[model samples]
Target chain A: MKLTTIAFDADDTLWHNERFFTLTQDRFADLLSAYTERDHLDERLLSAEKRNIGHYGYGIKGFVLSMVETAIEVTEEKVPAHVIREILDMGRDMLRHPIELLPHARDAVVAMAKSHHRVVLVTKGDLLDQERKLSESSLRDHFDAVEIVSEKTPDIYRRIFAEHGDGSERSMMVGNSMKSDVLPAIEAGAWGVHVPFDLAWALEHAEAPEGHDRFRVLDNLGQLAELVGEIG
Target chain B: MKLTTIAFDADDTLWHNERFFTLTQDRFADLLSAYTERDHLDERLLSAEKRNIGHYGYGIKGFVLSMVETAIEVTEEKVPAHVIREILDMGRDMLRHPIELLPHARDAVVAMAKSHHRVVLVTKGDLLDQERKLSESSLRDHFDAVEIVSEKTPDIYRRIFAEHGDGSERSMMVGNSMKSDVLPAIEAGAWGVHVPFDLAWALEHAEAPEGHDRFRVLDNLGQLAELVGEIG
Candidate 1:
């Protein structure tokens, strides 16, 4: 397959993301320790996130909102105003957190930029948060295009590929999430290259497509350029 | 003076948006009536919105967050958890709110769709919220493309017009906000048409361009098609 386009997922794929969420989640647990156990709070928060995803979509803001909702619910609507304020502060801190690029992220993007292939960042989250992260990441110039979507569906991958590159057949998507960045892209008739980040969010987990010819996995992003060359 | 592209802004430009915010603000004031005066609450909420715009960007979510922050601030952290829950519920209600298309919104879009020019929906707000509104509006099929941005600026307009249409010189942007939808668009070397909505957000208020050659204003969307035709 001639891969004329290489799309990368942001968040955990290019930079440290899920860890920040984990850190915030831990902080959330601490803030509510008096109201409920950590595990219960996590389950409720996750459930709230699942329920609210359709409404709020994905982002730090949604996560924080879910935490607040979960806090209110667990405390039986007795969650202190200061706890809510602290939760909001955590979200602000997350939004303002400096971008920390993962190893070889810049190199991989730079390689794709130098190559003939179109380099696009296909991420799903709050438009402003994604735009802010990308702007802060100092790697925006390496991309030919940026698509901050609400979700990564098969149809979305198909449309993005068709719009930014030759098509799905000539495109490859690289990222961390099996459910979001990999499987849907593979289903869209493109190469789905998984570069596993150490910490994965439970919502993003999925059974790996082991036997699919178009599916591939790498230990890290360092080998991405070589893999692209091999595929070409 | 060839107008090959006609771009329209979403939110109050094509639908009843500011009224909902006003309604939500009213509810918020009632919830905190014990703690602060209505005018004082409004002022605090506006200040919070302005300060938090950089972090939260724009949308019902941010607005709700700002309201929550204002509630906490106004009450000096004495606000009850039920009030916060009510505020969260208000945000959900706003997100789930049905689209109310403004006068002649459909006809104007249909008119532009039938014309030779490419029609594009250029909006700035929460991605999912805007998408939901567009989908619910049933006017999605009329436009050639949709651009939901974090903010609207001259550079953004130029890039959008160039990517989706011919370029800024051959494009015209129609919307409600003088700050967001008109002035920057005109600055980008495109025709900026203002369709004044009855209730305008204070943040979006701007002095109307009195005599700019490429600027025009209308009473409603009903006159948009005729205005475009006259310009051409």
Candidate 2:
């Protein structure tokens, strides 16, 4: 019953975030199909990220600016203002989206809350997008606090655990991403549980090295609740 | 016109290899859809690779055996003999495949052979599978020598260039995979050209950092011949 603090990731974790990014990207590709190549578009987006990382920050809105920049650069002076408007509107749709929690996300968070565990939501992205999502989800009440981080380094996890938890073996991290979530937590002397989700990138899905026993993989979030409950 | 040695990679560079593995995997997933999960299948295939790397070396044949081993383990000896046959058949097809050269692969190699280039086929895989592919391709005449390596390390490129081209800038490496083919060659002070192909694994597609002067990216082998001819 020692597991006290539970940390969760936000994007593609509590709600549908990446699917929107994927969909927007597909549409952007479709828009640029006549004028530019996917690789070129990707490079332009990368460039825009480099340019705006200090100003616009990161997430869908930053991606939106990059797409606009790419379109303008590729189309030269021939860029129709209407096309720019369309892309901006697309960005707006992303911002205004209703938070659709993944299956068992709400139930698990609610269960953890009722059990009086110190639940925290740790996520990386544009501050406004993360804030908008939390406000929309209405499940933010379940978490004791939320941390919108710039990156998910091991240091960040250690800092969070130290500030929020018993700073011992009672802290655990749950996430769908092995790289960003489980591995870093394990490195920070916290237990990690991995719940693999569909649409995980190939780089993110690499196998855990043999005999890495501090981590566990779950099929569903329900199983996570059961594990926490069992330990509690 | 100092380009002396030309090296080519096997697998997708010369012929079809990974697609067959992918097809077999999809079919295997279909067969085990009822009993085993896709993620479980993925985990076991990865596990088998880790387990057998010391024993079987690396390549398509090793991957096939891993698949077979995974099937048996997952099904608990209840898998039918026919199903096992199907898995074995997929492996055999890979081994028995006539090394069908990519478009302009043979013509470009022939052109280089007729020119002053010391054509070398440098590939990584199970030694037997790579040898079989070379023999089946009828490309034996095109290459003065062939190197069947276990892994494509930067050291491998350096050693090959030094041994084959007397450690001169007159050596060049050409292949479809960027991580293995181009970067290592560039890093080893040899000319490198990337011939991008469809369906490259994410691991094989690492980006070139900005401002790489010694590297070139070509759309096809035809372009590669022209670029080499121009450089020479």
Candidate 3:
């Protein structure tokens, strides 16, 4: 089927996102080093994130909140107020951090935009944070539409494709996370292109659909446009 | 111009939203009563909300973050971990609270859905929270579209109207806040209908546009469908 629409996942797929989360998490471990081991602290924070995802969803704000909760839990409700303040500050810093486009991200988006395809950015995170990142990314103009969703599920992929393009059969989704970006889109009857990033969030991990006919993996985004050409 | 679209604001307009925030603020005041006077704490929290809107935007998560920041500031960085944990719990509770429809909210939406006009929910807040509220409100199927934005501006209103309906000239925005729901939509060349809620956030206060031809103030949503009929 001809790809009438190409949707790219933001965050790690288009730019340097998880790295900031990682950096802030390292700072979190350091701040609470006096109260717990680094590994245990990390584990608690991940659990908090997973547990709170239903409440807080995804973004720096939720991440910061989870960090605060973890610190309190690990310290047995005695985590210092200064530590909480520092954690909030780290979240603000993350919110205000400059957008760094991943390698070949711009070229891939430009290629898709210039093609006969409808180029869309489908991302799930804090709406304001995602909008701010896109505005600062200098890649906003290349996209025909931007959807900042609450989550990336099969139903959501189906609706987005139907709304923004011909249908799921004539659309494609490319991203870093198999669980969020690739598998769901593939499940929705669309081409799912996986461009593996160097880092992945623990919650976003899933077994790759290696045997699926529509599933394809790329080493980087540099080969994305060429692959699309081959598919077309 | 013939009206083809009616966009309703979500929070204080279609649902009992600001009251929960008010209730939470009362709890916040009580939690920090030992550290400062209630009036001073309220003022500080308002200031923090205003100052951090650019950083956090509008939502319960931002409100909670501001509360955390205010608690630390007012208590001189010794607010105690329990207070922080309490604040985080408050945020989670807000997120999980069941949806409460405002007066005539359901009937007005139903009437608009039956009318020959496109009905849309235009709101500014946390994406997930808004979606969750809508999903629980049992009013989801009534609207033609839902636009969860960071902020409502003339440009945004213009774009949304153009995308969802004929144009701003043939559209109307009904809501509680004169600042967010009325002014910008009117500025975008659409009719702005104000349905005043009893409580208002400090950030949302603005003078009513008395003489504007396209501006109309309703006591509640019960008069909305009739007003649309009159406008048409």
Candidate 4:
């Protein structure tokens, strides 16, 4: 009954955000098919991630911009104007598409809201893209607080807990990532429930921490309610 | 001909290495089909890579051991003894396989030898594995010196140049990796010819150093002799 606050990650947690970008990138690959191959386009994207890390940080917007820049550079000024417009159109689609909630995300958030727990949506991305997602999800009203951050680290979660809770162990984080969400919350001295996504990028698949006590990886979010109920 | 020294990498460079490990991993995936899925097994390997960094250093031997240990843990004591042997046998195959040179590895080494260049094989691995590779390569005769090192750093190339050459721009490096082979050599004021491999692991990809002119990334090593011939 001491559980006071619950934090959730945005991308791949409540909705299918990355799949949109992935589809957009596959289209970008098709756009460059005349000039280069899919693997080559992937290479440029990988390089762009490394290049734009400082400028744009990380997210769909940065990725979209990088793809545009790469298309021009790869074609050596021979890229047609129609193709350029198509690339921009892809970005527009990524933004305009409605947020698609995961299997149990909306239901879980609603259930938690009916309880007394303070729910927070903690996500890191471009301000506009993340805010647009919140507005579209319609579950934004369920959260008591929303944190749009540049990076997810232990300090950020600790700050949230320190300000929001009475330094209690009842605070918990539920997310699809071990690297960004689960580990940081655990390091901040809160419980972490990991909902493992079926597919992840190579960079996101690091090892779990030393012990099993602080972390729990689940196949489905439907199992989360039972875990929370048991914790109390 | 100004070229005097040539160096190389050990894993995925001299023989068919990583592909064997990948195959064995696929076999491990088959064995764990009942307990865990392929992606989960791969996730465990990624975790082991991060975990073993402090303990195992890096190489095929350590990776094999980690794979075996993960298989056992994931199977939860239900793993059969035969599966363990198959994994060990696969590792042994990689350890014992003949140094089947890449398309032009031997030709380039032989061509370099024709001009009286002091060929030095600079590889990083467990000491025994490196020595075993050199002995089996029949390449021991080609190399004037062989360094079985723990890593390839800027200091490594600096020491090699200082000890071997007359501190001239006459030394050059040829390898499949841009991270360990090309970048460090360029940093140490030596020319590097990079032959991009099909499966360049994330661990071995380096960004080009700023304002460095002594690096060239070729599609393959066959062009190495010609590239060096032009540079010299």
Candidate 5:
């Protein structure tokens, strides 16, 4: 695969993000332990998220709302006000958390940016939260363009590539999610790089598009620049 | 003027959004009353928002973050943790606030939707928040497309119009913000309808392109469909 431009996903792929969500979820489960089992609460929240994704889209705010909804449901509408408030606080804390660059994240993107590739940050989530993280990440100056989109679908990838990158033939998306960051980019005819995060949100789980010629799975972000160099 | 499609801006254009922001800002000022005067706090917050727009983008999350940033600055980093916590509560209250439809918003968009026009919602804000509001407004089925964009510019308008609505010549945008909803649409060669909201955001304030052949200023959303019919 010969790629001219590489787009990086911000959340887990860039720095610590999903792990924060997981930590929050664990706290949420503890808060609701009296009402239901931890495993049951987890299942319920995931179900609520899947059901509400169409209505609420994606982001921490939606996740919080979904958690609140789940709390009410799990307790049969008897969830305590303080519990809801705690859930909201968890979300606020997540939003306010510092951006911690994963091992070799800066070097990987910086190396690519220094190369001929037109590096772009195409992350999806709350625009403000994503932008705030991007700003704090101190990697803003490196990208040619930054797109905080609602979703990462084939249509989205196709248009982003058309406008920002060099179209699918010469574009690649490097990220953690197979459903969001990988499959869609590959479906858009761009290379998909998977660097698995230890704790991914359950809703974002999907099997990689195995047998796709342009798909690569690296265990860590440290291998990114080398992979790109080899691809070139 | 002959219009084949009409796009409406959400937020203040369709409902009572800015008023809520104003109310929240007032509370934010009260929260920081220990450090600064209300007017001074307001100014500082706006300045912070302006400076952070590139970094935080738009929507309530950014607004809350700006309020927290302003609190920290106005207090010279001596702001109480509770004060910061209050700012986040203001944001949560906003997210939970019920959707209040603006005068004649439903009639305007529904009429255009029921007609041959490919009515689209071209509002800009957090995707989850926007979708939640859209769902709550009960106007989901009206628009042929709903774009929750990061920024509205002439280029953005031109591309959206080309893809979703009729090209510039046969399209129109109806909204309250001259900068975001009207000017850019007109600059893209589409007709722009300004239905001024009482609480126009300071950042969204801009001079409408007067003497522009397709520019129309209606007193309220009530006159929208009739205006479109008359144009036809």
Candidate 6:
């Protein structure tokens, strides 16, 4: 697999993103400790998010709103307004939280930059928040392009790979989500390398494309440079 | 000001966006009526939103979060959790609300396509929400390009006008906001046309450039086609 362009997923693949979501979620559960059990809150919130994804899409904004909705559902309309305020504060804090690059994310990209025609970051989230994170990641200079897309689907991958890379034959996507970063790229006829994250969002988890010719798995981003070297 | 490309702002300019926000705001005020006066709630919510924009940027998501925050502040942490839930419901309702096209938005764009090299829709908000709105507006085909940017700055205008249109010299930006749509485009050396909206967001309002050579004001979007024809 001679990859001419290497695309990275920004959230969990390159930086510590899911961990923030998890932390905020824990706080959300605690804020509603009076209304319901922690486990129940988590379960209900997940369902609300799944049900509401079509309407709200993905990202912290959607998550916070879902939490608000879930709070109402679980509390049976008796949740204190102050608790709602705390939930809003939790979302604000998450947004303000600094971008923490995962181990080896920088080195792997820097190494791949040597052989790749284009090193790109294709992330889907709030545009302003994503842009701010990219600049703060201090890795923007290494990328040939950055895409803040609404969703990651086979069609979007096909379009982006066609525009930014040489094409499927010479492009590869490296990321954490099997649902988003890997399967879509593989379906688009490009190579997909999945690097697992410990706290991957439940929504992002899916069975790996085990028999796909262009698919591979790495334990962490640290192995990326070597994988690219071999592939290149 | 002869123009090669014409751009329109999406929100209130193309469709009735701020109206949904206004309706939701009224509901939010009513939901928290026990905690604060409607006028005070409106004032506080607007102030909270303005304060939070730097962090959350813009959208229904930010506005909903601000309402939650204001509820807590007004109630001094005693607002009922059910009230918080109601606010979340308000946001969800807004998201699910049908698109209402502002008068003349379609005809104006149809008219511009006749005289311009490119007709573009430049909007800033949630990526998915904006895409959904554009498709729902059924105005997608009218635009040669759709820029869903994080923020509207002079630099962004310069870059987009250069790439999508001929350049700032031959590009014209027509929209509802003096701050976002008109000022930056004018500063970027493009012709700026302000079509005033009565319910324009407070954050979007600014002093008109009274004597700017290329700046023009229309009472409504109804005047846009004729104005574009005259300018072109």
Candidate number with the higher DockQ (3 or 5)? 3
TM-score of chain A of each: 0.98, 0.86, 0.98, 0.92, 0.96, 0.97
By lDDT, the better pick of 3 and 4 is 3
Q: Is the docking of candidate 2 incorrect, acceptable, medium or high quality?
A: incorrect
Count of clashing residue pairs in every prediction:
0, 1, 0, 1, 0, 5
lDDT of 2: 0.73
**All candidates' TM-scores?**
0.99, 0.47, 0.99, 0.48, 0.63, 0.94
When summed lDDT is taken over every stretch of 10 residues in candidate 4 chain A, the lowest stretch is A53-62
What is the Cα-based TM-score of model 3? 0.99
Candidate 5 displacement at residue A147 in angstroms: 1.6
Instruction: Please write out the lDDT profile of model 3 over residues A1-232, one tens digit for every residue.
Output: 7889999999999999999999988999899889999999999999999999999888888998999999999999998899999999999999999999999999999999888689999999889889999999999999999999999999999999999999999899999999999999999999999999989999999999989999999999999988899889
lDDT of 2 at A89: 57
Off by over 4 Å in 3: none
For candidate 6, give the docking quality class from DockQ: medium
lDDT of 2 by residue, A1-232 (tens): 3888999888777788778877887788787788888988767766766764543334664566566666767765345544555665577677677889899998988888888889999886655467678878898888987876656778889888877778636888888888888888888888788877777633345566346756888887878778886666
* Clashing residue pairs found in predicted model 4: A207-B47
Candidate no. 5 TM-score: 0.63
* TM-score (C-alpha) between model 2 and the true structure: 0.47
Candidate 4 residue lDDT tens string, B84-185: 546555665665666666676777777777778777788765445566666777767877767655567788788887666644267887777888888888
By lDDT, the best candidate is 3
Place model 3 in a CAPRI quality band: high
Q: Write the per-residue lDDT of candidate 2 for residues B1-56, one digit (tens) a residue.
A: 47889888777777777776677778888877776999998788788768755444
Q: Each model's C-alpha lDDT? A: 0.92, 0.73, 0.94, 0.71, 0.83, 0.86
Residue-pair clashes, model 4? 1
* lDDT per residue (tens digit) for residues A116-184 in model 5: 799999987776678678889899999988877778999988988888767988999999899999999
On residues A1-37, what C-alpha lDDT tens digit does candidate 1 reach at each position? 5889999999989999999999999999999999899
In angstroms, the error of model 4 at B204 is 49
Candidate 3, residue A157: the lDDT equals 95
